[model samples]
Target: MSYIPPHKRQTKGSPLLNPTPAPLFNMRSDFNKFRTWNIGYTDHTILKWFSVGLDDELRLSSLVSFQPLSPESFETKSGIQPLSLVSTHQGCNEGIKNELIETPWLLIAANVKKDLLLSFQHMKREMEEAVMAQVKPSVVARFGKILFYGSSSIGKDSLKLNSLTETTLRKMKGSFHTDVPPSYMDYVEDRVAENLGQEYVQGKELYYVKLSDKLRTKSIVSCKCTVAKDHNKIQLYKIELNRVRHMVADMSILGKSSDLRLFVNTKKIKMALSDEEINEIKDLIASAILDSEVPSGIRWPLDKRHSSGGRYVVNAIGHTTAKSL
Candidate 1:
């Protein structure tokens, strides 16, 4: 028995990507400028106020908030304190003013100090609200544009890289079929000729336009093949079947060395059968043909369009045979 290696058959057609990732961020300027400003300014202030209360009210430690510095610092920097617990309503009272000064200890012991913390919290919240007011739209707009509409056309560099990658892949895949044995290659070539109703010739391989309903319901040119044994003596066949149906009511069979393949256009076959079951039936029926046990009714209908009598239309092949109940 001669060895038949696994033949790498090259399909002479283009294939598309499984899932195409869409582009994000269309505009360069807007995408870059977005989120440049900090929206956490108010959050920072609130954190500082909490820090202050931890030290002053809770007496947790002597650490003053390094940020949002004390009212005294505000007076020194801006020529005024943000809030005054002391009033100069009395006439030129230096001693009273000195006593009321908002030292760290005074703020800690004040009865209304909780109110001051609450006011500080409210102010921090308001500042945060203001900062986010400016930042939210820019951020929202960036995501909205990306989700609703893809980025503008890709750059030239990216397009060129994709093209190069596709071309290289095709070249690599093309090299695979170049090593297939001539006998195996001939098998595929003959099937193509038989499907197209043309005589099988040497050198030139025949190709058929396969029609599938599910994968787009379109036709694709494919290499046809018949049953052939591998080196392990395992019978193998490659035939294109319609996507919509299970059993093939219509097909074009191509034979090789007494091995015939029933190309079932299962579109008309309403019944279902596993590949193993289908193969078993085909082998059994073909064996019965060799033994002459199959009924005379089992015949290929003549093609009315191509021949005078019409084509061979068998209800079932292999194991599953159709019979009137």
Candidate 2:
């Protein structure tokens, strides 16, 4: 009998025999193209109060207010003891006062100590009320001026890094104009692309983007990606089916072919598949394995058996050696 190579073999009506063409949507390129516009930013001040039970009363141990810190700073500072518990009210109050002495960022009322000795819940409520009552009026008075005048001045002076508006573009053009007018914009775009690419591609993080709703109804299709280090590129895989199915692994001697078994619940699938569909799925799996660039001396056979099952069991065999290519 004549032998044909795996890649050369052609089965009639096999989708794998003629693989589907690549789509227009290149995930990496498309993501980089719109990364800047899709990027989001927010600025806000947070007020936090550390409390500890003293005697039968709850005391506002420490108060701090600041903008959000980086993940590393937050992680490190979160574990630090903000307030130390003392034996007496005088010591506790003195400790808090000493901590707040140089810290002008915290807005604590003069009567915070007087409001102590209340229930934990009540103390938090009263302290929050007092802080807001004192702070809200001042904020309201200055908000209008800040909104109308301060924002414009700040906007003009601050570096607009990722803004894509026409006004921002014009401002950038005026500030960094050279003999080649488009060079600066191109450089900025490339830098933004490089940053995003480094973060998502080079970083050890899996990227999964969901497909459109129009694609399927029950199971939402998604594109999963991982860096193929050997190939020095990203490998994108689509996951369309995610139903909980019984898996049975039939491991054999290393380098020896093992039975590829798939057990599915008929009720879950909800329909009986024609032979053509089964062949297509099998062919697809075979094509994927064939297309994969396996390490030299490794051989993974394209053979599988489908069975209906409620439970599945896996079996392992002895070690086998592979011949070096």
Candidate 3:
């Protein structure tokens, strides 16, 4: 019997949707010849012997003993058919050998375990320290300047002066002169006239005063005054009555109230690994692992030998603690 490719199998259903039956092989003679070679036999050869469809009880017994029964003994088993085993075994062996040749690396880095772990920890710590050194000084300088200045102007042009509204001016006057003496109103009037080139008049109750320029074209300024009841003195000492727009709008209300707080945030700097650096590290670790010999009893499957080595190295490095370096 000749070997049939899965696509060329005589099956009515689709091979993908309904899998074709396992290939049969006349392994009775080959099994006797290679029965003693089980120690060195690969999984591919063992699987072919299994696909011969031996009885469940006999298959289990043979697997346990790691031996193939005689061809005459298989004659008693119903529906036991033998086909070409030599060609299938040769194909399986060629594939297995090619896999072994391609993946000359170990599945696990058992030899360089300590060295790899130490190197990873050292690399992580060095990277963290370098990043902190680069970022800490800039962050500290910016935050310190903000805290020390507390929104003070560094130069004259930095401060802007804006006009105050009549309603806001009235409120300022009321708050400042609420507890001042009647004589304080006279002093305020003199100051207003001297500074603004205006004349101030006292009202009947002295609770508020109206002021106009010398030409009296229109009222230029208004004043409100009151006498203090507790101290019987004036409390209108520093009255500028001007509100300006802030340079930093976010921190505008910082000093307006005693209990108000302003929070300043620094932009976060992201630490990223570039493709070049990632590839460099992977190659470095792969070289280290391949330089060491693989231990016995460790099976280097095709997948592990080819690409999984790099993945394992990355995962191992990531698991280490930078602080513990």
Candidate 4:
């Protein structure tokens, strides 16, 4: 590998220390700056109240939490000793203060100490809530946005001392352009020489996609395709069949490949066939793939259960093919 000099080297930035790493989405700033030597805070400010571990009661990272430094909130944020026990209170005023502190919570926050009461009459929903209910639903989307939203690649390997994704690397791979070439038009013309085909191609022209010198040598042009109008109408018929069910019925599993999708669900298929034999049989189902749409090529008709016909967005290539492919 070539050397990357001092000025060219990308240095690491501090992580955005999530004060409450609980759901992560509940907080935002993505760089950590708390531990580095540049700050107005002292270790005692954090260490004196928080246990160096979790210790969320004193929300430190956000700098904008409501009643942030109070332990006597939400019936006390937690039972950690750093926050004093409320039983030490001395009057009706103290009870009033405690009630005011707990006003925000719908229910009391669970704690190591409070849970030991073992009162069968009580339940903490946050702790004992159904697994499905307490799940952090938005975390996956948030994480994808932070680390991979702008990433690009042809394949997924990289070893050039790059940490962040480089879109330039994808441009380096080969030309990926939308321009339709003249030969591509001819190719498309050859496939559909009918009246409707001529009408579709009558004014449609191809544009050459310019490319970088490294990728210009690749044969990147290919015919673009779309669902033909008549085929599209057939698809509409298929949708109509589903909506007005009494008019059309799906063949029995023993008779044809029902719209059921799993390739392994070979109910109507002959059981003795091997993978090569299956691919060979499926090959008999001539398909003009919408390369722009079905970027992941064809791998269907795993058995001899459906008939073939018509032009097909192929959202579920299984449709139209319940009777035809």
- Give the TM-score of each candidate: 0.13, 0.18, 0.14, 0.13
Clashes of 2: 0
Encode model 4's per-residue lDDT on 262-318: one tens digit a residue: 000000112343455334323323333323244233323334223232111122232
lDDT of each: 0.24, 0.24, 0.23, 0.21
| lDDT by residue for model 3 (1-325), tens | 9897633443233221221121222222243332321012212122111111112212222221111224442321233221111111223344433222222122112222332333233333333544422221111101110011101222322211222122221121000001223364556576855687776443322222122223223212122233334433211111111111100101101111111111111211223534653453333323322111342112223343322223221111101111110
Show where candidate 3 strays beyond 4 Å.
1-16, 21-49, 53-64, 67-274, 277-280, 286-325
C-alpha-based local distance difference test score of model 4:
0.21
Taking all chains together, the TM-score of candidate 1 against the true structure is 0.13
Q: Which scores greater on lDDT, model 2 or model 3?
A: 2
RMSD of 4: 29.2
- Model 2, residue 214: C-alpha shift (Å): 1.2
Model 2 quality (TM-score): 0.18
Q: Give the TM-score of candidate 4.
A: 0.13
